[model samples]
Target chain A: MSASAGSEQILHENTLYAEPVFHVGQFPITNSIISSWIVVLLVLVLAWSLRGKIKSVPRGLQNGLEMVFETFFGIFDSITGSRKRTLQFSPFVMAFFFFVLLNNWLGLFPGFGSIGQIVVEDGHKLFIPYLRGATADLNTTLALATIAVVVSHIAGVIAIGWWKYLNRFLNFKVLWEIPQKVIKEPTILLINPIKFFVGIIEIISELAKVASLSFRLFGNIFAGEVLLASMSAILAFGLPLPFMFLEVIVGLIQAIIFAILVLIYLHIATAAEEH
Target chain B: MESLVSIFHIDGKLFLAQLINFAIIFFVLYKFAFKPIAKIMQERTTTIEKSLDDAKAVAKKLAETGLEQTRVLNEAKKDALAIVEKANQAAEVNKQKLIEKTKLEVAAIMAGEKVKIAQEKEESLKEMKQEIAGLVILAVGKVIKEKMTDDKDKKLIAEIISR
Candidate 1:
């Protein structure tokens, strides 16, 4: 098939690219990044505007903000099982919630995907200009996952001293103790190997956390965006509206899941295994 | 044609992209949104707790004042009752003394009147005895005169005197 004569050949070249946003060297900025920035600015303005009016007797926006915190605190307390820890860790948890929530909701904005410049590549015109959902991008999700994992580890280190936390990954001392334990009880050797293997598996599980956290958020959000786009392309009118509302709910759920997962990671990290 | 699952496959580039994005978002949010909100919430909680403390202090003060007022009222009531009791006792003693004094004065006046009556009775008895003696002498003289004639009686009386 001649490139220009082919039926699949289109006016826009870059429109058909699977990933709409690309990187400038190391930085993987996308429509999601722009949206995230918008969200950040929005949050900053909202918080900054209402900074001084914190009242004991709830009034206006302060009341609303308090209710939100109380709710977050309550949920966090339930997860962490202590108000002290919730307060101790509330900053990270609440930040996760707001960021994830905003990023997910930003995808639902009108003209995010549809309103962008057309890029030409390989004699075909493509639509890749601006505005992709941050969560839809693997970069956003993976970055969040890394932060969640790394920060949680740091929290673990702080909560239970560094050596104990390091013991989670490497436990040669426990392995060395096996000979002495086996002398006392013949069954100790079998149990020791099992314990050793379990610790190894625990190490793998920590690596798995990155995969799980990133993919879960990316898949759900990306799938929702694709679903909306495809539905709108198919029906073009009334059919997409209801699904838009459904996507709103989905967006909220995905945001909640991401935040809760981060919170759970933090909770597990901070908890001492208690012998 | 590749399957739909192939499109969603995990890749290193995807992970890298997400890792960087997450870092940016986390930092941005930490600086702008989360930190400020957390601070506001903490400040708000402190404000509420302070108001509660102030309310408690005021309540304690009110309780103390109430107790003080009650104590003062009780003391005043006790003092009033004591004064009334003392006045009653003084009145009773004064009434008893007045009664005893009046009785003594009446007894003295009665005794003096009785003595005066006795003295008057004695004087009257003496006077009556003197009157009775004078009347007897006069009667005796009259009887002698009647017994004798006048001149002969007088001459016999003179001869007796000379003897």
Candidate 2:
């Protein structure tokens, strides 16, 4: 399988980052970006094909899609505890799930990491594949997590007024109420400051959510890719099959976990705070 | 931060591209898949509910009609029975009247026959007395040589017949 493009030998290694494939006006297009674009195109085409066929009675593909949607809706409802909230948050969460899932599964295909060009840099040959799993890249997962967390805050602001949503982090209302309560209940002097501190901690936790969300997805998918590469490098054929199947399951699980976390965040964000 | 960036190769342009990609997918899938499918499901649920209500209404109407039919049938049967009973009573009255009228006519005919028989017996007895008287007169005449007249013989015959 080793072919000579020049006097340099091709070196294939599982990199922690998505390699740049091409450049367009100072913007480098990475393999992960390509995979993401392919996922987007595939999803758009599937949706477009199923669009006109959606009927009230629902037959064939429509029937299967409706069942899947209903099941997912039920799962969202269980997290949000309200169907209205689930419906409001479903688009973003479902997009994240499908995009991540397709990227993970598509990365396991035959020619994804195997088919590439040999680039000679400083007399050292590097094999750069044309496609990589989008979730394996930290940039993609970070972007999705940023969107999820930011949208949750926006949804919170919309659901409960902006001032009320802001109180989740800053808690200025509790601090302001201390003077009023101090005369009636002197214990407010101690409890209100603690509550304000807790609100500060809440802000830290929100940041933690973004970090955890992005890192978890990136770590899982990246590790799966590394594992498959190592297994194939060891035996070149049969050894990677089991790991591929494991990656498939891991891909499905990570997608579900990411979607569920987003839904939970949405649910928590939109809920009215009890004073 | 530099080490992390260089190690992971986090690019701002790539992040933006991925975000745009996810946004496009979200809007398209929402418009083409979820929205229409949810709407159709809601419609199917409402249609099923409406059909169930219509079926319930039809069943109730059927039950009501069945009850009305049973009531009407029972009323007609009662009326028929009453009519039959009245006809039987009328027939019995007519039969009794006919029997009474026949008995009275039979008694009257027996009385008329008795009167006719008494009259005929009286006429026959008078004729027999007259013949006996004539015979006695003839015998007396033969013995006493016609001592009595015809008018006196006739009067004696009438007296003997009356006795």
Candidate 3:
């Protein structure tokens, strides 16, 4: 983090935002975006290779990929409790895991924070890395979270009827049940209102779900980046190695956590009833 | 809220770009990777199940065939024993009939020989009577010629009876 050989002092800060490494026309490509693009390319090439080499009896990379798929399916089966629904939801969820996991791991490479261009920002020489962790940035996590939630809702609508799915949020069916049941049971009137309010809270919880999903991943990865930066600042060699290993485990855990959470959401959304 | 946005530098274009990135990743993974692989795994599971079923069926048939073979073998042994028993019984009957026939033939020959012997005995007794008559006549003539005495006649009769 120090300047090179008697050059003027530079202030290096691990910014909360992903720094733009370049501009393509009006669109600025951030470091995290570049990292994600690399991840995408890697994933595509991997997919192509696996597609080429895939066999009924898997071998090599195809075998590894099959293991991942089978493990994801098992985790998904535990969550969804039905193979049909697990099959429906696991691919989308696994995509999130692979994306988050790869990005988080790629950030640990040497060039990520160290190799970059220096620019003057607010009159301080700023070191902008060309590639950062995609999940470490808020934008990527937020977008992924939003997609997961939106897709869950869509799955809910597709699984159950849209009318029933709507009642989960608005409690239209419960409100309709109130007038009929209030005469038979007086407690129904009070309980139904509470249930309606609970439905309203459920609406808020959906937003909370997105926030929690995005923030949890973003926080863990971004903190890892900052921790690695701090460790590098202290000693740069032996110190960062431990944290680097920790980040690797953290990266895999966070990815699995994100996927499981998405699967849980998918399960909840696609469930036949409120219970 | 504005300060928070500025701190994170949340950008719509960036969010859109990331979304776009995720979409492409999801598509490629779902289409080219996960879908096909999971399907193949499921197919593998199905194939294994089918093979297991076939093996079970073959084992069951083998057991059934073994049972059938045992049953047939037991029946054949029983039939063979029955045939041997029947042949033994027939031989015993044939042996009894032959013995009875031989016994009848021997009895017939013994009866004819007995009749012949009786006839011979009767003829011999007749011939001996004629000779005795002649001897008595000769003894009477001798007695007359010898000048008759009661004691002599008695002596002659005694001798003739003794002889």
Candidate 4:
């Protein structure tokens, strides 16, 4: 429904970016940020309900939460191989999972893409929804991915010593070992430089990890929203049902994929030096 | 880089905002959900293990008690059988002694009765001899009308009758 805010016509269109809902003293609060805040509030309310009621013998929602946590621990255990490591990594990793999953699924709620203000912008009316999918935006996914990758490096530093953790990317150790072991193993002359170069390549790959992680999640969720919009445009009714179902499944899978990839990076980062 | 940034509308402010949001989610979940639930799960596993161990000990003790009861019963049965066998042996010995004592008593009574019968026969014979002697004397007196007494003949007749 197009409503006139002024003489300018309403521009009902989907943009690649999250639209700003309002301005808070030069700080623009976008629809995606609103969605994320809603997710945060939902968690807070759920957490508040069980604040003091967390018993050893759980009931109802607590029981369901325990089951979910157990399942998550099991799945994370497969990635980390040790339950201790799983515990170390699970909080951050599951944050990603819950944040992405809830944001993705909740994006499909009513009044997300369909309801907004008809504001005159650039001599044209634009429809800006009050909420959008949090993970569907690049900033949110990029933030999550950057956090995941950066935390891996932190975990690496904590698990291994700083020097050992640092060598994974820059690899000054192989270079240092060259003068000491080159006499006994002459191949060190050739292999150490190559290994050093490989470490440099690992640096590039780390950047690639951020890009890939962010792009992968943002692409899938944004595409799902776009696909749903396209399908709704084609036929507003039952034609989009299957795609909605597909989007649901896709939301779950993409969340799992992101969480698992983050978990793997954590594992690889923290593992002890083999050689 | 500019093109990609423009295309995605990446903003540092929004990025930081989402980071803070994710931080809130993490803190709430970690403080409320993961830590307590993990603690409870660990406790439940511990309880289950302790219960299993207790059950194992109880079962073992039960088996041991069963064995002890059987052993006590078997020992009692064995002792009972031994006592009965000892009693039967004593009864048989007592019966043999009673039978021997009865045979001895009957023999002694028979010996005494034989002695009595012999004595009685001898006494009656003595009396008969005496009476016969008297009758001979009277017969002579009546036939001869005088006392013709012959002691040797009397003695000889007496001896022959005794033989």
Tens-digit lDDT track of model 3 for A1-275:
44562386666789899999888988989999998999999999998887756678888887888888888878788878888888888889999999989988998888887788888777667888888888889999999999999999999999998999999989888889998888889998888889999999999999999999999999999999999999999997698898999999999999999999999998889889754
lDDT for each residue of candidate 4 in B1-163, tens digit (9 for 90 to 100)? 9988898788889999998998999999899877777788889989999999999999999999999999999999999999999999999999999999999999999999999999999999888878887786677567767765577557755776667
- For DockQ, the strongest prediction is 4
Q: Is the docking of candidate 3 incorrect, acceptable, medium or high quality?
A: medium
lDDT of each prediction vs. the true structure? 0.72, 0.88, 0.89, 0.88
TM-score winner: 4
Better of 1 and 4 by lDDT: 4
Rank by TM-score, highest first. 4, 2, 3, 1
Q: What's the CA error at residue B109 for candidate 2, in Å?
A: 3.6
Task: Give the per-residue Cα lDDT of candidate 3 at A75.
Answer: 76
Tell me how candidate 4 scores on lDDT: 0.88
State the fraction of real interface contacts model 3 keeps.
0.84
- Looking at model 2, residue B23 earns an lDDT score of 92
lDDT value, residue A60 of candidate 4: 82
TM for candidate 4 is 0.93
Flag regions of model 1 displaced more than 4 Å.
A1-29, A47-63, A119-125, B1-40, B43-47, B50-72, B120-163
What i-RMS does each candidate reach, in Å?
A: 4.6, 1.0, 0.8, 0.9
**Would you list the clashing residue pairs of candidate 3?**
none
Compute each candidate's TM-score over C-alphas: 0.77, 0.89, 0.87, 0.93
Stretches > 4 Å off in candidate 2: A1-9, B124-163
RMSD of each: 6.8, 3.2, 4.4, 2.6
